[model samples]
Target: MVFFNLWSVLQWYLRPFIKWFLRKTTRLCELQRICYGDKPGAERSRNVEKSLMLSRTRDVKQVVSYLDNTVLERSFVPRNFPEILNPSVAIILRAKKINPKLHELFIVSFRRCLAQIWSYRLLLEEVEEMRKTHYDSSLPEHEEKLLKLWSLLVPNEDLESRVTKQWQYIGFQGDDPKTDFRGMGLLGLENLLFFASEYPQASSHVLSHSHHPKYGYTYAVVGINLTSMAYYLLKDGSAKTYMFNARQYLPNMNLFHKFYCYLFYEFDKMWIESKPENMMEFSIIFKKFENAIRNELADPASVFRINIEVDTI
Candidate 1:
């Protein structure tokens, strides 16, 4: 009777944890299947494959095997934030030419507004903490600081109130990979930042050339390992480093222009650099690259796309 009673107690205590473990395992299996592509026998083999991969108990050798050399190189190279800001600066310059007032708007979006958004995010976190602690002491001080910051950043009281209210829902809680901004594609945070920092007259600047009225261009290049190389190069400074990393891609450069149009166009204004002296050389190189990829690159459907989760508030 005692043994049966102990077994019952153990089951009761472990039921919730067992249920959670099963749910987590199911989700992981689903993700793995998605990554491997839905082949006929893929699902059945995954569990066996997973067990084989994890069964290795070696210490140092296991770590060495998992180390990605390319990632290590990229980590060492420091990227200059200023280079990324160049596009935003160009947008401001173009806007200033059309409407001087809008140049300030771009600055506000890039600088002040972005800063205020972070500040509000921090305030929201503190407010949540205060709620958990059930203390009014932290509330007064936090409210005072938030009010001061809000007034300086947002002059309009109504707008400040509205922004604060909405911020509560959209608050970033933790380093949740699922909440990363990659999943939304065109409507993602990167686009939002570009949208905010870009001037109202961006369309006009992009459409300035009579022959092409498109607002943006995309560049898709192909090479044996251009994707792998470019991914790292983007993290580092000096355009020269990128050129070196992607040297092999140069031969097939033509593939880039053929597949992705953005390479030849300025992202903010979408100006085409097709003139012989300008970016024609780039186009030729990229077209050949595209052709090579089309011939050699296997089924692209099996390619793993980067996954970023969106946090909808």
Candidate 2:
């Protein structure tokens, strides 16, 4: 009993020193990795680390604002933050010697902002690339995927051609579906394909909902509109809270796609619940939905996800 008491007393006394030592050692290792990692852009990443550290003395809000102005406004690419921030946080924690809790909050918030920036940049690149890639008849792969998507979503009906009036049933603007894709380009098509492929029953069910006699709506057109909504929310940083809270470190394409899925599902419910008079009221309804999303995202802890069961579909 005496030995146990002595050991416990020693442990209590030495715990803080042990923790400091561990932190120092880990920070050193992270520094080494940042400097010596085999990645292609080690130098550029190191430059970012230097820049971040140079501004470490700045208030959290100032740093966050700077990030918002700089990185968020830039073009997308696969980022080096995932590699850089691990050690950067350790170094910041050691160098700043701030209150542990405050230090943690700053680090976490900064990381979240960086993650949000990266996701936005990545998504922007994707959208831009898709916008530039016009649909071509020569690409068998693209044609096949489009056909497969149609088959998956509308299994009962056979599409006669790539261009058909049947496209209107799914919410295309006209007989030539490509015309509708002029704004969103291939990204709209890709989003639809993903929806149909990933959630076959849900996609079909939503299609059926689009055909309601009293309050029918265009599925594909509305989907493209929702894509624009998602893009705007992401671009304006309104979706940051949702993305940050939903993820531990960073958001990626899968997460973005999930957000799209959530929007698609929720928008359907909202439409049914509101029971608008006609398609002409779509703009009004959409504005209301956008406002609702913005309001929800005003909360720091908001996380958007598809919560409805698909088994019922």
Model 2 C-alpha lDDT per residue in residues 178-228, reported as the tens digit of each score: 777677767777778888888777887788899999788999989988877
Please, what is the TM-score per model?
0.18, 0.68
The clash tally of candidate 2 reads 0
Query: What does the lDDT come to for candidate 1?
Result: 0.29
Model 2 earns a TM-score of: 0.68
Candidate 1 residues 1-313, lDDT tens each?
A: 9999999899767755764575477633221222233332212223222332333334322322332221233221113223433443344334323243534443433332212222222323332332233212235653443344223323344333412342222221222211322232211222222311232133223223322333122211111122222222222211111222222231122211111222212222222443333333544644554443333223322221111221110
Number of the top-ranking candidate, with TM-score as the measure = 2
Candidate 2 least-lDDT 10 residues: 38-47
The parts of candidate 1 lying over 4 Å away from their true place are 1-61, 66-207, 210-313
Alpha-carbon runs more than 4 Å astray in model 2: 1-83, 90-120
